[model samples]
Target: MTSQTDGTAPAEEFMDKVFGDYVGANAIFMAAIGDRLGLFKDLAAAGPATSVELAERTRLAERYLREWLDGMAAAGYLTFDANGGRYAMPADHVPVLAEESGTMFMGAAFFDYSTKFGESFHALLEAFRSGEGVRQELYGQEAAEAIERFTAPWFEHQLVPVWLPLMPEVRTTLEVGARVCDVGCGQGRALIKLAQAFPHCELVGLDRYEPAIQAATENARQAGVGDRVRFEMHDGAAGLPGPFDVITTFDVLHDSADPAGLLRAIHDGLKPSGRYVCVDINCADRSQDNVGPMGTVLYGLSLAYCLPVSLARGGAGLGTCGLPEGRLRAMALEAGFAEVRRLPVDDPFNNVYELSL
Candidate 1:
């Protein structure tokens, strides 16, 4: 607590480095260990089990399991019953930490994303500093496949159903046989849904990744929307093939080169009053934990997984994958939107914005 003539050092300054770090930096590592060891969820629904009991039930190494639970208990990731001599996951935290879902859809995958990729975030700062982009070694064809899998099912299962209930505004703006461009559309998921919704709307899914576009085309064909929607290998940064009645970028805007510029291009591509919908998570939603496990992992993915990969071909930084509401609204306004509105979507993990010009 050294006080200087200029000013006194704040308590937060010292405590932040010492004790106030409630979020453990190794939280991802812990999650990975928990998943690998099969420790957390074993005792999750069984109320609580003593370390000895957990070891017996899970046939895990006792001492090692004890240490893990002890650390996890300390971190409030689990609860240890003093008298009952068991550990259990709290109800509030259980759903957030979905363990053992068969297909690796838990928060645990972010650790892999971070370890395999988080360095790019630091490297990105340097790249931005030096006016040189990241190297191309990081993103392979696997990235396109990953994007297809991650976004396709959700778009097919969740988003289309969610938005179908709320497309009066969309229907009003659409003309029969009007051209619809699904910009940055990965695997034509959105277009499939759109084709089904407005059967008469001529739809095209635009993406810079040729592989992605091809996959989207195949998916569109499989989904029976092939004749209605075509996946085009196109560029959003340079421009889009318009004038489109509706331009949709689903979970794609945040990874663009200049999202604002793309919006302008989209605006120009659109007819008089076309709807531009951008679906993504807000990077800076205070309601959600920004630096918490889910947020950081996604941010890392944006840096390593999405941003540079998109830029390697020819695209812009759309909105940092998970940018905030205020920044997104401002970007849309700057892009020459006559009307910009943020529609609250039904996705818990992400938010959707509808910007019209």
Candidate 2:
């Protein structure tokens, strides 16, 4: 009976955890709605306003804003001034949700991701049963564009100043006007940054998605680097035209249908002295080693999005968090890279690697 009680306790405890997660997810959904509707930003700017005041300021319905404000207050995202009958976003929370360009801005990104996940849930369910998933097209353009926006803060703020400078040689190569290609360059944020930073370097952004390429091309034009920065609709596996000086793929290799083939193609296209820089999720080779909320979230994303897209292409699906250093090193070596060295970077979610032939 004592042993039965022990087993039963664990089951009950697990169920408690599951219920807590459901609550957390609902809160996130409400937060995302608030973000999408600009309720949080408005409240933050107005400083302890009633739901009616917030609605008046934002031109939204008072009834909906009232309900949303109450939900946020209960979720602890907003503090309720019970005496004054008002609500407010805590000062500490403002930067996280409102400051899109700041490093601390994560709420908007997570909101975009969660909303997209919710939209894709049905397609994901079908993919689980059939082993053939919906493509990125099914998520629609908004979701596709959200990915670029979500990652823009880091790319704009860190890529040029912090990450690129880690490899002095690569930095020097780009400074000297070399041909550079960004494979799977969604929305061309990174490439645009690179183009602005190194005007001498010729830049090419490639993605299989035409919508992304179109966006990227327009983005470069808006950034005033369109003369030197170009976008191409091409699969990474098909490879770029040869003798390129530097090739970089930010969080893209694992998303490939044929990552190994893509690597080989990258190697074949590069000049003898050229280098390949890959940025991907920071993860462990074993499941047991990944022990935390971040790991759980990444694995959930793998199941919902990353794994499905690659599998849908009838290719080796190295899901999100699947490319640990050891596996990546092995694949890089097999693809004719003589060396694979990890660069020192402080990013919590990603690791950078420099591969050379």
Candidate 3:
């Protein structure tokens, strides 16, 4: 290590932060590998075991498994028992790494997000130089599938029970068999859940990505809601068929290149008495104001996915963390919305709004 001379405190501090980030990056990737290979799940289910034992259990190569298990141990993701010559995931950490459908499941998903960023790094570098955004398609199928797994827990647990109940009127409308549309509905998990929850509501899922739309269609068919829920590969800025009783855009509004135009389309497509529901990154308007862990994650995600895709389309780039409530309300108002009411709910990542025309 180089010795720090006088007046080098700032430089030393910066270098230390960089070194820490480097380690963190490697650890995240290793965690993702463990998740992908079902190593964590096996550990959680089978208790402490040697790398050789784990290799046999998972039918994977022992040499790679040994190093991965060591990495997990060094990262404190797993406990090393020298006395027994075995390694195990801590019981408390099991849910966070292995239970994809549960609330505590976050580590694996973040790893997926990190992997996507790495995949797009080259194009993102070009976009940074050109001042243009990376195209959404460049993110590719693996990233898309990873994102679905990442968001599944929230859509599965919170969307219907916690969020929908916040909008009693809209919930009642859906309960009574209203027409519903989900804009930018990536893989259609939300639509499928909604269909299951409210079978009478006619549902439509829309996205510009054909691959995502295809995945959504397949998911709907598998979920046995294909009859009631249909998907379309349509751009939101082009406007939509009219008079949907309830419309939703979850964690997607800020990703739009023309959020105002999309909002206008949403407003115009809704029935006079219809409701528009959306969830976007919960952030302060100013970049400097976005602080703490969640804010850091949001900004990282912005650079990785949201900001680049909007730029790819040569549209308004409202980087993920840029859309604070004030800006959101203004955009909605400009789109002829009568009200932009923030729904009362507690969430770490998203702010829910109920818009009316």
Candidate 4:
């Protein structure tokens, strides 16, 4: 009897883990299908629909569609009614998936990753074998640029509010007209934001992708900060061009293939005792505050997608997991930053660390 119970427990545990993976894998496909097929849109318009109704309206096979709906229901993504014979997205959740504040929009990136899941796994296998993954296109320069563009708003919206209070500190160092280098400045969002807020400051956005630099330049122009904010292509891995008064990176360090080298370059690029501010995923539960859903999602992507992409690209990319302020401070010391601190960000959903060269 003990043997029977013991065997069953292990089997159940294994099955549970497998089930979790299966659901997560299939959810990625379903979410992508919903976006591409407009299935979710149809449901939104009709208010609620049975699988049969959805299939007929969508011109999909009812049986097959029902299976997908069943999975969605079981996974808490779909709500079912027995008396009414309908399935629907929970009313409260619909807005989140459909609206600007939704995790679903940001989650769209995961589908792209899911489509190339096998390649990542294979590259991971190779990495484990040789401390390296095969040369691959999964997270190359172009892909990184695209990811930055797609995720920038999602990232900025969450973190900017956190950084607002620190503006005083930022302004103190920049002296209202000092130059600031936004290294790894994807699309120049930070520069645009800063320039808009502090019209007198000079912001230079440096990135590796020409297209991204162009986009950032255009965006800065659009934001009416063109004269103050400029975007240029820089080999982010090599360093920044400076003597600038301040330098900042928004979630850039983790993506570098050689973070130590990049840090050293930035150190050399800055003016003496230049100020630095960085915002990234809190890899450590330092806050002891459980990260909200969006933060959690970014953290997961950093692990399952970001790090692997780095390894795949033959770089030493890794997510910071919002590690403790002290851990970041330690790295800054190693990187030759003079003073380091972890500051509570003014942004509603982001965290910040401040350092000096």
Candidate 5:
């Protein structure tokens, strides 16, 4: 191969990288299919089975199951026994693929990319050409549900026990029956978890998305926290229903149409002694500093969803990696916050910031 740009065979190296990405993409699509069909869960539960046996168990077509099982085995997502003519999901893979409540579960990511991002590809391409953006509503309920599924495990397992304890003062406030609101509260998982943990606290969840609000309300009811928690469709950029003891925004600000306005609203909404907990993508202000797997995922998501969604509404377009600690601190200070501290919570994909008046 002819060398281009660099002395070493650049074309060959680049093509190798491209092929690797292609294989990864195919694996993701396959994973999405398996997740949608409950193939992984069945395989994990039923143990090794021939395609026919698996088909009988899942009530799916044998021919399709055979192809899918072969693909999964090829991708190393499942083990294949040639002599036995059987396939099985590994024990360790069960937590990631089959168990929704497991902390390491990642089944929803496939749906998020294949269903949500794939559906919006043409719109995103148009936005790229016109320097405009795709609207959030265009992604539909699939995106909302995928996001809920992706974040629910974290909220269920970590929010009350792991994350909240980092902010002892806020925990104490909740314990004392403080009024709290979670902005951009998709499906009300966080607030529902909080309600279950701190029974005395009054919790409310707000999101601009109608589908998400509806889901949140239903989910709260299903969790039996309907009376303790309320879900409302409210845009924080316009204002917040306040005098709150504590407020939270999880993975929200970067996708805001008016982040600064929202920050101001949060500041004004809080009581004098209130605290604001801001959870956003873990990122650095400078582009050069962001060079890793998480950074790649965040930046890709920014292009596919976050940036465009915000820009569609005449927003600052602070894509996924835009909000680092320094940027948030400055914005919070300008929005009248007296203190903005990055909490020492150790999370790979998110940063926790505590803002106080």
Candidate 6:
């Protein structure tokens, strides 16, 4: 290989990275297939089995199962007994794959990357050329469901116990009785969690996407918070129906059509003592500072979904890592928020900001 920039060795190293990424992508697609088919769960529950046994257990075709098993074994996701003709799910992998409610569960992420993001490749390419961007509605239900599953553990396990406690005043208000709204509340998971935690509080969820709103309504009902929580299809950038004691935007601002307008609406929607909890990607203002594994993932997602979705709505197009603490504070101040405080929530994936009128 001839060197284009520095040397042939660097070119070879770059190609190695590209090949590694290709392998990783193939592995993720396989993982998504396994997740969708419940193969991992069955393997974990039924113990080691051959392709034919797994086929009988799952009622899937034998040849397909055989190929999938071989692929998984090669990827180190399963242990293959060549002599016994069986494949086993590793005990350590069970939590990350089969246990949906566990904190380590990452099965949904594979689906998100493989189906939700991968399916949008062509649209993203068009977006790159035209600068018009892909619309949110284009991704549809799969994206919503994938996102819900990806974040469900956080809402279920961490929201009430770990995250809310970081904001004592807001938690106390919820403990009593307070009108709360969650903007961009996909499937209403956070509100459902809040309703379950604080029976006295009135909770409402709002999202621009109709499918998400419908899903949220059904999900809230299923969670038995139907009477307590409400789901509405409304854009927060327009105006919030509020005077809410507490309002939250979880991983929403950067993907919003008008983040500044939404912030202003949130500020106006709140009572004088109301608190706005903004949960966004944890990142630095400068690109150079964000050069690790998390940053790489965030940037790739931005290119695929977040940035384009916002641009399609004629938004500011603040990509995934666009809203660091400094930018958020400045935007909040401009929106007439009197105070903006970064909470002491120790989440690597998200930053918690408390804004008050």
Question: Clashes in each model (backbone N, CA, C under 3 Å)?
Answer: 11, 0, 0, 16, 0, 0
Q: Against the hidden true structure, what lDDT does model 3 obtain?
A: 0.89
Global lDDT of each candidate: 0.67, 0.86, 0.89, 0.67, 0.88, 0.89
Model 6 CA deviation exceeding 4 Å by range: 1-6
Residue 172 local lDDT, model 4: 64
lDDT head-to-head 2 vs 3, winner? 3
User: Per-residue alpha-carbon lDDT of model 1 for 1-357, expressed as tens digits?
Assistant: 466554546655767755544355566567657754566567666567777888888888889888888877887888888888778888766654544332335543343343444445676677667645665444555445445544544565555556644655676655355688888887676788778777888888888767778787887788788887887777786788888877888776767766767777987888876777777765664635577656655665666656665464455643244467777777777888877666656454567767777
- Tens digit of lDDT per residue, candidate 3, span 1-357? 555666688888999999998899899989989878888889989988898999889999999999999998899999999999999888799889888789999754587888756768999999889999888887888888887887788788999889888899999998999899999999999999999999898999999999999999999999999999999999988998768999999888888988989999999999999999988888888888898777888888888988999989988889988689999999899889989999887877879999998
User: What digit string (tens of lDDT, one per residue) describes model 6 on residues 130-249?
Assistant: 989898878877887888888888887888888888899999999999999999998898999899999999999999888888988998899898999999999988899999999999
If both were scored by TM-score, which would come out higher, candidate 2 or candidate 4?
A: 2
Candidate 5 per-residue lDDT over residues 105-148, each given as its tens digit? 88885545555677888999999899888988888888877888
Residue 290 lDDT (model 4): 40
Model 1, global lDDT: 0.67
The C-alpha RMSD in Å for every predicted model, in order, reads: 6.5, 2.0, 1.9, 5.0, 1.9, 2.1
What would the per-residue lDDT of candidate 2 be over residues 196-233, giving only the tens digit for each residue? 89989998988999999999999999999999999999
Which stretch of 10 consecutive residues in model 2 shows the poorest summed lDDT? 1-10
TM-score of each: 0.63, 0.95, 0.96, 0.73, 0.96, 0.96
Question: Which lDDT value does model 6 have at 131?
Answer: 89
Question: Clash number for model 6?
Answer: 0
